[model samples]
Target: MLKTLLVQNYALIDTLEIDFHQGLNIITGETGAGKSIILGALGLILGNRAEATVLKEKSKPCVVEGTFNLAGYSLQDFFVDNDIEYADLTTIRRHINPAGKSRAFVNELPVTLSILKDLVSQIIDIHSQHQNLLLADGKFQLSVLDSFTDNLQQLASYRDSYQKYRSLTSELENIKEKASQAKADLDYLQFQLKQLNEAKLKSGEEIELESLQQQLSHAEEIKSNLQSAFTLLNADESSILIWLKEAVSSLSKISHFFNPAEELQARIESCRVELKDIAHEVEMQNERVLLDPAELEAVTQRLDMILSLQQKHRVSSVDELIEIREKLDVQVNEITNYDQVVSQKEAELEKITKLALKQAQEISDTRKAGSKKFEDSIKALLTQLGMPYADFKVNFEPLGELRPQGIDRVTFLFSANKQMPLNDLSKIASGGELSRLMLSLKSLMVKTKGLPTIILDEIDTGVSGEVADKVGNIISSMAKSMQVINITHLPQIACKGSHHFLVYKDQEKETTETRIRLLTSQERITEIAKMLSGEKISEAAITNAKHLLGSELN
Candidate 1:
């Protein structure tokens, strides 16, 4: 329940604070008496958008704050989830700066507007004139039925299953599309893989083959050079080895006469041995340097194959070609196993569909079972609200396709006269009838949903006399269970409140500001008297106001 509301620098309200009670708290004033201004300020704290024009003082910020006693509301989990401090007396505040920037806080901890909206929605419901048209909305109608049937958990389960079914179905479609595209390229991929496999590719094979080809291409020049060198060293008349041997013989003969001659003979003998070894190596190369055309052709063909594959694959190395082969192998394997994957996903989808259908059917059954009781309750409440001839029915139709809620579409049908045919509520009900109907629906929901506070902005609009009394009675009864704050001009409704507040404009030297005060008993008499007889209160009007308030208290 809301304990206090403080609004500062808001439109037409420089600074205003009001304390609220647990029961029906009535606010009454003439038209344009700043009642809407107060509601607008409350809206800001409940996460509504703020505008710079709402600032009464253009240079100052507008602030709206509400204190709520959350003892039995079971909101500890919500506070913990949002990482806010839990307090029995929770404070929700909103500030709109002069530049149109808005900020929200819960228990002094700053939070996002969406989080604040979600949290406040759970604790309070503000039903304005526009919300009464929600009776025409199919989603809201279904929600109301579901709420009455207590189908929240069942609806949640159905939605979960439906989501899974949709996800699996989407996956299956993607896989099938991929498989189709892969099949179109399957033949080309297979041919490419086979070509690579038959090539028998090897690392560094291209480099080695290129070197061998160069040597084989110049085989004649190489062999001729080797033969020329061999002849110069061993076969020629003035060969190096022959000259060295003759020198060594001359030096050896002089060795008996001088030591220097003996040293010269040993050096010449070493030169002759080295030259003889070079001649033998050259001879061996001249004999073995012949090139075979067949081997050369094979090496050339191998190098051509490697280069061709590299060009086709747009790569510079045999190693890169190998990478392409691995990637193709994976695609081929996936295609080969695609049927199995698709089958598994299809099976999963089918299972989830069955579960979703079961849950939806259960929800449908519960709604059908509870529909009669729900209809009876609304009809009975409408009767009490001056619609004794009203006929209410909850009509259900097959939705044909699965939905997040269920497979049923619900519509509320109404007839105000017994002889008239039942029509859609939106098409047939008048504003007064709609208000009463909305109130009755809200009254019913309070029993099931346990909303802590409900603020009705002129719910008694278009109603008067006994019907207004019934509306007041309904609101009064609803307050027994939760805090009910009603902003109205109807004296019948205003007189029924356990507490009465007067919202009126006060004119200062420069500006007019809206102010509200909890009226005393005598002040209530005057306010109700004003509501009954306008600005000029008559003696009879005062008596009637006293009689109305006295009777409503009983």
Candidate 2:
């Protein structure tokens, strides 16, 4: 519940602090008495956006702060989970500097506007004149029903299972897509491998074939050189052997004069014998040097095949060709076994999806039942709020198959009179009807959702006289279970509050200022009387205000 609210330099409100208590707290004043200003200031502290235009004279900034007591609530647990401080009391404050820069703080620790919005919404539900219209929204309708049924734990479980199922289904599709793509690539790879394999290519075969071709191209020149060497060794009619024999005899005759030549004669004969053997080997090689045309044709074909594979694959070396083949082989294996893996994933996803669908359907059934109860109770409330002849309906639009929210799209249907058919609430609900309906629903929601406070701004805007009184009573009944704050123009509604505040504007020093005062019992009578008769506080208005108070006491 809100313990106190403080506003500084906000709109006509230069400085104001209002303390609140249990039960209905009503604020009343004349039409332009800054009553809505109070609600707007409270809104700022509740994470509503603000502007610098609200700043007062001599004030560089506008500030709105609220303190709340989270008694018998799980708010502290939320703070703990979010790693925020859970003080004995929580103070939410907002400041807008002169330049229109805005900031918010929780427990004096600055936080982002989004964080303030998320946390404040959990604790306070500010249903202004327009907020009640959200009741007709489809998503909000589902949420209200779900909240009544306490389906958070179930919803969380179902969502987890649904997401897992979706992920697995996506994975299965991706695998199948990859398998199809890989199969096409595998076919192409196999064609390439067949071409390479049939070529019977050898590593370095290009370099070796080129070297052999050079020798084959010059075969005639090589044969001629070999013949010349053969002639020098033994091919001529007068060979070196004959000349060496004659020279050896001459050396033998001179050997008697030189002893060294006598030893040299034996070595010379050894040399002549080694030369004859070398000449014989050379003659044999000369015959082998001539190339065969058939053998050359085979070599040329092998070299051509290797060069073609290199050109097609764009590889300069045999090592690179081997590496590509290894990669293709692995890809082909994965493609060949793709069906088995995809089948397994599909079965897994199917099993989880069935389980999730079953759970979602169960939740949907429970939600429909809860919606019926909610509809009946709220209709009962509206009947008491002077719409006894109204009809409330919760209609379900059938879905052919199961979805995340089940097989139905829910809507709130309503008919203000018996002569009318039930229509979509958003299209048919009037502002006043929506206000009462929202209050009734919120009254129910507060008890179930454990929301700490409910603030209704201008709840009785269109209501008057007796209808306004009944609206007050209905809101007061809700206040018995939760703290309720109302901003009202109706005197009848203002008199029913357990606590009353009177807001007014005062002019002095050529400047207008707004002020808020907690009304004592006597002050309450004057304010209530003023609300009843406007500027004229006649005896009759005071007497009627007293009767209204007396009726409230009853």
Candidate 3:
């Protein structure tokens, strides 16, 4: 329930503070007396849009704050979810700067407008005359039936299944699309993989092939050099090895007579042996260096193939080409296995679809059963609200496909006369009838759903006399369960409230402001008299106001 509203520097409200009470709190004033301004201020705290134009002083910010008593409401989870401090008396405040910047706060903690709206919606409902159009809305009608049936848990389950079904169906479609696209590229991938496999690639093959090609290309020059070296060392008559052996023999003859001669003979022998080994290696190399065009062509072809593969794959080495081959192999394998993957996804989708269908059927059946009870209850309430011949029904139509709400489309039908056939509420119900119907629906909702607070803004606009009294009685009855605030011009409704408040303009030297005050019993009588007669209060009007107040009290 709302406890207090404070407005500062708001439109036509320089500074105002009002305390609200439980039960039907009636607010009354003449037209243009700033009654709606209070509601507007309340709307701001409820997370409605704010503008710089709403600021009374262009240099000052506008502030609207509301205090709510949340002792019995189970909203601790909401506070924890939003990371806000919760108290038994929670205050929500809104501030709009001169630059049109708006900010919201919950318990002095900064919050987003969405969070503010969500928290406020759970605690208060502001129903204006414009909201009567919701009576004809199909979603709203279905919600009414659901509320009456207490099928929120079931609806939640159905929605969960529906979401799963949708996700799996979407996954199946994507897999099928992937398979279709992959099929187009399957043959090309296979050909590439087969080419790579037949190449028989190896690491470092290019470097080895290049070295072999160089050796084969210069075979004649290498053979000529090796033979020349062998001839100089061993095959010639005055070879260096022959001279070194003769020096070794000479040194060996004197080596027994002199120590230096022995060392010299050893050095000369080592040189002769090394030269003989060099000549042998040269001779072998000369024999093996014969020019062979077949071997040259084979090495050249291998090098050319390595270069061609590197260029074809846009890589710098055989290693990169090998990596591309591995990737292509995986792609081919996946294509081969796509059919099984798609079949598995399709099976999963079919299972979820069946489950969703069953849950939707259960939900539809519950709605069908609740709809009859809802229609009967609303018709009875409408009759009590001065629509004695009113007829109400819930019309269900089959949907072409499943939806989140289910497979049924609901419409509310109404007829205000006995002989009239039921038609859509929008086409048949007048403004007054719509108002009464909205009240009837709200009254029924109170019995089913535990509403926190409801504020009716001039719902009694087109109603008066005994019907107005009945409207007052209905609102008064609703207040028994929760807080109900009715802003009205009818004395009958005004007298029905447990507490009365009057909104009027207070003009000072240079500024005019709107103010509200709780009316005492005598003050209430005087206000009701003014509403009964308007502008001029007569003795009979006062008597009638007292009698009406007395009757409502009884």
Candidate 4:
């Protein structure tokens, strides 16, 4: 319920504050008396856009603030989720600076326009004449039915399943695409892998093979050098080994006569032994050196093959070629098993589709179950509002494929007269019919849980006399359950309100400003009388006003 509205420096109003209460609060004024301006200020509170042109005071900012009593709205979770301070009595304020910059605040904390709209929508519903056209909107019709049936939880479930089904279907498509691409590359990958496997590659084999190729390329020259060294060390009679032995013998003979000679003998013997080992190693190396051209050619061929493979794979070494081989192997394996993987994903998608269907069926069932009740309620309300012969219905059609709204497509059918055949509500309903139908729907909706305060701007547009009185009675009845604020020019409707306000213009020295005041009982009667008879309140109009106000005349 709206507690109060403070509008400052906006439009024709320099400053204004209006206190609102629950039940059917009414505001009445002549045309162009700034009732729309007041509603425009309230629009700012509902997160509507504003411009610098709306600022009445060029040097000051325009401010529109609303304080709402959120006692029964169960909106603590919304505040918590938005990280806003929660209070039973919450204030929403909008400020448009002189430069046309707009800002919104919830409980004095800054918020985005979207957040402000969402929160205010939960607590207030502003229905102007334009909203009557929503009767033709398919989505809005479905939402109205769903809200009537309280299918929010079921719809939530259906949407969750629908999303999962879509996700799984996408995943399956991706898998199939990958499988197709991999199959196209299968033959080439297999050939490459086979070639690598037959090569019998090793980690360091390339380096070893290159070294061996060098040695084999120069084997003849190397073997000749080793033979020469062996012959010089041991093959001839005057070889180094024999000379070293002679020196050792000479030193051994003099070692007993001089201690230095003994040390010299030992050192010469050590050299002789080392030289003998070198000669033996030289002989062995000469024997081991291969001079076979065939073996050299094989080593060269092996190194050439390694270099060719490296160039083919665009890698620098044997290790990199091995890596590519492993990757190709994995891809080939996946290609071989793609059918199985795709089957699994298809199965998952099928399961999710079934779940989605089940959830959609639940929503459809709930809607269908409540359809009769809804139709009866609308017809009854229409009858009460002076259309006793009106017919209303819910038309259901099954959708071929799932949508965010589920598997059912709902249309509201209506006929305003007995001779009229039921047709789409938008096609046959007149503007007056649409207004009454919308009010009827609103009256029904007010009985549902968690509905907010509804503000109707001139809902009595096409109604008057007894019908206007009945419309007021309907509004009054709705207010018994929830808060309703109606702006009207009809004295019948205005007199039906538990509280009344009068909107008029005030002329100061330099400017005309819009003003509104809560009407006292006598003032209310006077205002109602003026509504009955223009600016002149005649005695008969006053009597009628008093008569309309009835027992609760205070």
Q: Which predicted model would earn the best lDDT? A: 1
Alpha-carbon local distance difference test for all models: 0.91, 0.80, 0.89, 0.89
Candidate 4 lDDT score relative to the true structure: 0.89
Candidate 4 local lDDT, 1-554, one digit each (tens): 99999999998998899999889899888899999999989999898888999999889999999999998779999999999999999999999998999999999999999999989878888888788889899898888888889897888888889999999988999999999999999999999999999988899898988888888889889999998888888888888888888888888888888889888888888988888899999888888888888988888888888889999999999999999999988989999999999999999999999999988988999999999999999999999999999999999999988999998888999999998899998988887788889998877766664666999998777888888888999999989878899999888899889999889999864899999999998898888888888887788888888888883433
Misplaced by over 4 Å in model 4 are 5-18, 28-65, 76-85, 91-121, 225-289, 501-517, 521-547, 550-554
lDDT tens per residue, model 2, 39-137: 888888777777777778535788899999886877777787666798757999998998888999999988888888878887888877777767867
Best model per TM-score: 1
Q: Sort all candidates by lDDT, best to worst.
A: 1, 4, 3, 2
TM-score of each: 0.85, 0.72, 0.83, 0.80
* Stretches of candidate 3 exceeding 4 Å from the true structure: 44-62, 80-85, 95-104, 110-115, 202-216, 219-299, 302-320, 506-512, 551-554
**Candidate 3, residues 1-554: lDDT per residue as tens digits?**
99898999988998999889999999999899999889988999888899999999999999999899998889999999999999999999999999999999999999999999899878998887788888878888888778788877888998998999889888888888988999899998999899889988887778888888999999999998888888889997698898888898898888888889999888888888998999999999889886999999988988888788889888999888889999999999988899999999888888888888888888889889888888888888887788899999989898967798888898889999999999999998898898998888878776676778999999876788999999999999999989998999999899999999999998864888898999999899999999998879998898899999994432
What is the overall TM-score of model 3 with all chains considered together?
0.83
**Between prediction 1 and prediction 3, which has the larger lDDT?**
1
Q: Which stretches of candidate 1 lie over 4 Å from their true place?
A: 50-62, 96-103, 202-215, 219-290, 506-512, 551-554
RMSD of each: 4.5, 7.8, 4.5, 4.7
